[model samples]
Target chain A: MTDRRTIYLDNSATTQVHPEVIDTIQPYLSEKYGNPSSIYHKGREAKEAVEDARKKVADLINAEPEEIIFTGSGTEGNNMALKGIAFANKNRGKHIITTKIEHKSILNSAGWLERNGFDVTYLNVDENGTIDIEQLKKEIRSDTILVSVMFANNEVGTIQPIEEIKDILKNKNIYLHTDAVQTAGKFDLDVKELGIDLLTLSGHKMHATKGIGALYIKKGTKIEPFLHGGGQERNLRSGTENVPEIVGMGKAAEIAKKDLEKNRIHLKKLEKKLKEDIFRKIPELILNGHPEKRLPGNLNISFKYIEGESVVLMLDEKDICVSTGSACTSNSLKPSYVLTAMKKDPVFMHGSIRFSIGAFNTEEDIDTITKTLPEIIKSLRAISPLYNKD
Target chain B: MYSKKVMDHFKNPRNTGEIEDADGIGEVGNPICGDIMKITIKVKDDRIEDIKFKTFGCAAAIATSSMITEIAKGKTLEEAKEISKKDVSCALDGLPPIKEHCSNLASEGLRKAIDDYLMKKKD
Candidate 1:
């Protein structure tokens, strides 16, 4: 399905790597192919490049460069942060707090922790997918060692109240970690100002190459090494440094930081226009997530009495890429757990479609979607026995 | 991932829409799983003279609906009753493993329609 006219709106899955990032990494892949650990001039060049990338990533999140540990991806970063802290502070406490709307990485890692003799409390989210601060506060206990929440949800694009959460944990002994994969590049995320103890960032979400991400470990936070090897990443994570990908991520981060305002505006404009047009065209269409505190580019909606998978396939035929709430990966035929957690009706959950707009999309792309989608929904609804096409 | 035949059937489905003046009707699957197929049939003596379908599902569900209707039309009720899920999938080249259940719905819907026809004939 390689259509030159394909409009990719699934940015939450991954982003198209920026040309500047590719340009920045070409030399590292070709000429500067030395290992960062080698004790020679070429190695020193590679080491300097890695450290420079570290600084750039740190700058993107407003963390000290020394506190950054490069990992394979956002999943690895989350694993390291949750398991690392859980292992290191096992003696202090074994209780961890998280929200129900976290990505699979956080939920799975928490599940592992729970299976391995640790206690975890999955805080319930409201209808908008935002966790209640009062519930989180009430859930904190003396043995609670860490609290991990996502900065913003990937599916519904609900921005959590991290700043308020920081205030709740300020006087406590617990460490706060956020899987900031979705919010890192799209928004102005300053870990320092947000009082985030640990932050996870994935390169692929920010127009950088995949397979390279960073974990922000605030100095003096108790954490054991999740990965053991040749004692790399300050003995936290050990692997041969991915020089080219690191350089790509660094350039991407620099560009993201510089273009933050412009990108935000562009995404917001597109999201607003698309939502407005779609709402005007389709009645009884339900919007998911927070109205104001959502990702700028996200527009999730449910077309009642129609299946989201059908809509996705129809849109795919039109060369417009989209995603449905139900994961088409496994044959289980289950709807989105995230939507279920928010207490959405089982029938409506199957109809939810997440249209995550990105920096690469144009107004023309939105126009194509807005023009074609209503007709598609109309046809599907006509065939639907539940829908009365009056 | 759907086969080319499946995509073709989905793109241009045969025997679409509802048979308003029908002899028998069958609806299978549910909206909860994001699939619901309603099959309507017109019977002449013991043979299916016409068949139409309306579906609310993904590509596979609609294609299977179309495929089953095409397989059943002009066939004796006894012969149409023999068309299994595997037969419908085979006719569409093959469906994805996950989507094989859609073909099951297709076969089930046809059988229900035939059963409805038999019940009506007795009435």
Candidate 2:
């Protein structure tokens, strides 16, 4: 932010495609662009590539290759997991449970289910943004067939207790589904250990191209296909496979696994440095998330008397990219629902900003952003008549 | 955070804290929105004599509170009631697109204070 170079701190929105991932998928996109369903030699090659990618992605999540279902994105994967399970197992139960702080994709899907015909319970989150397991237990009904909670929140980056959720629903025969888009590449993902019957992950969140995602269904978990066509993914997904994007996603997962430990440590360093500097330079700034149980790359802060959007704009002037909220909803005048659900005060909500780091970010980038931020805050506070030091 | 203009107001906001035994008081916005402001006014002969505020949230909230008090000082209740969000924003040279609501919160707080004053007289 101090230099002429721009620093990007919004990786939670979507990561840039790693050079290796882009290179690996080039041959499939141009030279070997054959329909995976085609019986010809190139087509068979393309089909085999998709399968190889599938196996790699499965390995990344510790799931069987046969259990994976390809989809358009994380939203589609979420819809399929919720809607498919809701409609298929209707007779077994009409109750579904999710948290109030889930991504809009999951919430919207839940809304659709409620609109058509289904009972849904939205559990509340604590001040720190973690849901209570006991409340979840209270909400679970006899006919509760599905419990779909997210693995991690995109905004606050509070890692949910997915393992505990798995344990809670273990004896009840309720299916546990998690939207792990924010956690797949950044954290260890073991479906069997977590007891997730259905899991969703997006390619773009982990350095793969956008518009490609995967849904992990444990063996013997029957979910009706959300989209029907040529029965491409073992009749579970009917459209022709997205060969290039699928391969890219698989490669991204493999790369993430290979460097996950290193990346985590690096991001943790960045976040630590950021917090130390922000608190040191700014007056009355508060970090908003669980101290230990948070994503390493996510740093959500509440400035005492400044608007998050003005901060973003000020930083943007220095070519430092960050988020007042989600990039998807940055333009919206409404404050983040995640913070609102956390029960943050209105003034604090308007003043909060999220800075998500990524693989490409460097120590210098963090330093520059840290240096540039206090000045911006100081300036906004100066003109901000709302700021009352007295 | 903000430019110099914003920082000045945040660091040294005018008419800060609260005015006890005031003629009128107004509280607007809610915690759900993450910005809340309470404006207290001391008026004599329908003319605002003094103003103070206590706010709990962000720069815009603090700044808006500061600006409203500064704007309302010495002005008649009618003049202060006519103060719009645009006037506050104009005083501060405009805000970021997403922060327009902060200005609105300020206007609402000021209007609410006048309403509280008039309603008390009726009672």
Q: RMSD of model 2, in Å?
A: 5.2
Q: Over the stretch A1-390, how does candidate 2's per-residue lDDT look in tens digits? A: 122377889999988898889998999989998999999999999999999889989998999999988889999999999999999899999899999989889999999999989999999999889998999989988999999888888888898998888878878989999999988768889898888899999999999999999999998986888667888998988988899999999999899988989999999999999888888888887777677799879999988666787687668777889988777776666778888888887667778889999988998898999889888777666543367553
Off by over 4 Å in 2: A1-4, B1-123
| Clashes per model (N, Cα, C within 3 A) | 0, 45
lDDT of 1 by residue, A280-323 (tens): 99887788888889988988898888778778988999989889
The fraction of reference A/B contacts recovered in model 1 reads 0.55
Evaluated with TM-score, which candidate comes out highest? 1
Kindly give the stretch of ten consecutive residues in candidate 2 chain A with the minimal lDDT sum: A381-390
Candidate 1 to truth, TM: 0.96
Return the top candidate by DockQ: 1
True contacts kept of each: 0.55, 0.26
Model 1 misplaced stretches (Cα beyond 4 Å): A1-4, A326-332
Q: What C-alpha lDDT do the candidate models reach, one value each?
A: 0.89, 0.84
